[model samples]
Target: MSKKNRQIVLASRPQGWVQESNFRLVETDVPALKDGEVLVKNIYLSLDPYMRGRMNATKSYASSVEIGQVMVGGTVGKVEASKNPQFREGDAVLGYFGWQEYGISDGKGLQKLPESKDIPLSTYLGVLGMPGLTAWVGLIEICQPKPGETVVVSAASGAVGSVVGQLAKAHDCCVVGIAGGPQKCNYIVQELGFDQAVDHRAGNLQEDLEKATPNGIDIDFENVGGEVMDTILGRLNTFARIALCGMVSQYNETQPAQFRNFGAMIASRVKMQGFLVGDYQHLWPQAQEELTSLLQAGKLKYRESIAHGVENAPKAFIGMLKGENFGKQLVKLSEE
Candidate 1:
C-alpha cells in the first residue's frame, strides 16, 4: 500500500453548467488504518445525476457536499489493508467511498461483493447496484405494473430507465421508452425489447408519444422530468401510477420549472410519488434475488458507458447530465 492518497475535491458550486474549475485534484497522505478499520483502493467510481444536486448547498433528499471535501460517490474497491475481522485484505467491497484513489472505512456501510461467474464486477455499480435497485423499487413498489398494462419510461437507455423498461416487459406490459436520439431509441426498441420507443428530441414529441401509446399510459417510471413528463402526464390513464425516481432534466436548473398540468393530478386521480432507494433498503435482498434471476434468464438487459482514468471522472459526469452517456456512466480509476 502507498503512503499517499489522491482525491477530487469540490472547489465551488455551479449556477448552471458545471465546469472543470468546480473540481480540484489534490494529493494527501493516507490515514493509518485504526482498529476495526480498513483501507480500500478504488477500482470504479460511479457518476450519477444525483451528484449534481449535492454540488450545491441546498436542501434536498440528501446532504450537500461541502466545499473542499471529496466529491461524494459510490465506489467498487479492493481492501488493501484491514484491521476489521469481517473484511480481509484483497476482498472486493462496495460502499459510499467518495471520489478518491483510496478510502479508509471502519466497516460500517460496507458490503462484500458476491462472487458470481456470470456477472462482472462493474455490474455491482450498474444493473446490480444502486441504479438497478432504484428501478426495482420504483417499478415494483411504487408503480406495480400489471400484465397487459401500458407502461412509459423516460431516459429509457439510461442505467435505471433501461432496467425499468425491461422489468415492465417482463411483467407483460406494453412498454414505451422515451429517449433523446435515434440510436438510443433504436437500442431501446430493438435490443431491450421495449414494445415501442419515442425520440424525445424530435420536434413533435407529444405527437410521437401519442402515437406510441394509443391507449392511455397506466404506469410511468419517470427519470427525466421536464417536457417529457408533461407529455406523459397528458396521456396518463385514470388511476395511473407514477414513480418519481429522478429528475435528471431539472437537476442543473437554477430554478426548477413548474409543471403546467400540476392540477391534472386531481382530475385523473393519478398517484405520483417520489422515493429514495434508501427508503426501501430492507427489500434489497429480495430485489437482488429477483433481478439476478432475470439477468441469469436473459430477460434483463443493461448498458454501460465507461471513461478510463480518474481525471476523466468529471468529464464523464457532465456528459451524463447532457444525456451523452448511453447507459450507466462509470470512471475506472485503476485496475487494482
Candidate 2:
C-alpha cells in the first residue's frame, strides 16, 4: 500500500467564475483503517459544473464547500484494504469519495459494483451514474415527450444534455440540440443522431432554432440558461413541458438568472419544473436497469473528457465551467 494519500482541497471560494487559485493539492499519510471500515484507492474523480455553485458563500439545495476541506466529488475506486465484512480487497465500488486519491468508508453510501464485461467502469461516474439518471428523470418523467413532438435540449453536448437528447431520440421524438461550438454541434447531430443541432456560438441562434423546429418546441430539456433559455422559451408550443435541469450558463454568474420569456409560460401554456436527481431516489433502480439495457442494445452513446491527474482537477473543473469540455469531464487518479 502507498504511504501517502494525495488530495485536492478548496483553498478559497470563488466570487464569480472558478479560478485555479481556489484549489490546492497536498499529500498526507494514509491512516490505518479501523474495524468496519474500508480503504478505497480512487480511480477517477468526477468534474462537473455544479461544483461551481458549491464554491459560493451562499447555500442552495446543498451545503457549500468550506475552505481547506477536500473538494467534494463522486468517485469510482478499488477497495485496497477492508476490515468490513461486506467488502474484500479487490472489490470495485462507487461512492462520494471527494477529490482525493484514497477514501475511508464505513459502508454508508458506498455501492459495490456488479461484474460487467460490456461497460467501462468509468461510465459509472458519468453516463450510468448521476448525469444519466438526471437525463432520464428530466426527459422521460418531467418532459414526458411524445413521438413526433419536438424536444430541444440546451448544453446538448455535455454529460446530461447528451444523454437527454439520445433518450428523446430513442422515444421517437424529434430531438434538436443546442451546443457551444461547430465541432460539438456536429457531434450532437452526426454522431449522436439528433435530428437537428444549432450552434449557440454561431451568432444566428434565433434564426437557426426557428429553422430547426418549424412547428415550435414541444418539450425543452433545459441545461444552459441566459440567452439560450430566453430563446427556447419563445418557441414553446401551447401545453409544452420543460424539464429545468442545470443552468451552467448562470451557475457562476454574479447576478441571478433572468428569463425574458416569463410571459411565454402564460402565452404558450408551458409547464416548466426544476428538479434534483436525489428527489426521486425510489426510481433509481428502475432507471439503472433501463439505462443498462439501453447500453446493451446500443441505443445510448456517451463520451468522457479525462484530465490526467488529481493535481489537474482544478484546471479541468474550471475548463468545464467555461464549456471547454465536450462531454463528461473527469480527473484520472490511478489505474484500474
Candidate 3:
C-alpha cells in the first residue's frame, strides 16, 4: 500500500461540546497488509453520539481515544488487498476502522457482508448494524414490551429510536416518540407507525407528554437525559421498564445535571438499566437476521442524514450534537 491515508485525530480533550480544533486532519503512509491481514478502503463512517464519550480521556465502559490517536468509529470498507484466505480484494466488511480513509486489519473483529446489491452499503452503518442491534437488544431484552402496553422512546426519530418504535409496534405495543421538532415528530408518528409523538422542543413538554401518553408509559427507551427524561419519568406506569441507551442532551455537560423528579421512579416501581451494545454482542447475528427480514419485507423503514465528504465530517458531527440530523448521522468518504 503505497498510497497515503488521511485521518481525523484527536488533538485535544473536549471540555464540553467538541470543536473542530479538537480534531486534526493528518496524512500518513498507508501501512502494508502483513500475513493474515487485509487492507481496507473505508467508504462510510458512522458518527454516533457515543463517540463523544470516547473523545474525553475518562474511564467508562469503553476506553477513551488517546490524544493524537485517530478518532475511533465504525466503518464499512472494501478490501484493497488481503493475505487471509477468508477475505479478498473487493470484499466489503464492517469493522472498527476508525476515522480514516483506509485501515489495516487482521480480520479478527471484521464481519463479512453478503454481496447484496439490492441494499445500499451505507445501510450497514445504520439500520442493519450497530444502531439496529442496539434498538433490538434494548427493546426485546431490556424493555420487554407487551401487547397494549405504552412504549415511549426519546430521540424517537433517530436511527436506534426509529427502529425501537417500529419494533414495539410490531409487537402490538402502542409507541410514543419524543423528538426535537414538529417535523421529526411527524415522521415518527406518520411514517414509522408510532402511536403519537411529542416534541421535546415544545414549550410544554410535560403537558405534551401527558397528552400523548394518556394511558401512561410502560416502557421508556431513554435516549436523551434532561427535561425530556424528567417529564417521561413522571408519567411512567407501575412496573415500568426503562432502557438507558444514551443521554445526548447531557453528553457535553461538564457536570452532572440534577433531575428533581427521579423520586417518581420509586412510586412507579420503574426498573432503569444502562447498557452498552458491546455487552450484547452474542445476539447481534440474531438481530441482524430479524431486522434484515423486516427490511426485505418492507416492514422496517430507516433514514440517513449523510454528510457527503470526509472533510465535512466535523460539521456533520457538530450538527448531530445540536439535533440537526434527522436520522443516522454518517460521513461518506467514497463511493467504493
Q: What is the C-alpha lDDT of each candidate?
A: 0.90, 0.91, 0.90
**Model 1 Cα lDDT, one tens digit per residue, 37-109:** 9999999999988899999888987889999999999999999999999999999999888888898999999
TM-score, model 3 to reference: 0.97
Stretches of candidate 1 exceeding 4 Å from the true structure: none
* C-alpha lDDT of candidate 3 relative to the true structure: 0.90
Error of 1 at 48 (Å): 0.8
Ranking of models by TM-score: 2, 3, 1
Better of 1 and 3 by lDDT: 1
Root-mean-square deviation of Cα positions for candidate 1 versus the true structure, in angstroms: 1.2
Model 2 lDDT per residue over 69-188, tens place: 999999999999999999999999999989999999998999999768898888898889999999999998888878999999999999999999998998999999999999999999
Instruction: For model 2, name the residue pairs that clash.
Output: none
Q: After superposition, how far is residue 123 of candidate 2 from its true place, in Å?
A: 1.0
Number of backbone collisions per candidate: 0, 0, 0
Off by over 4 Å in 3: none
Off by over 4 Å in 2: none
Against the hidden reference, what TM-scores do the models get?
Answer: 0.97, 0.98, 0.97
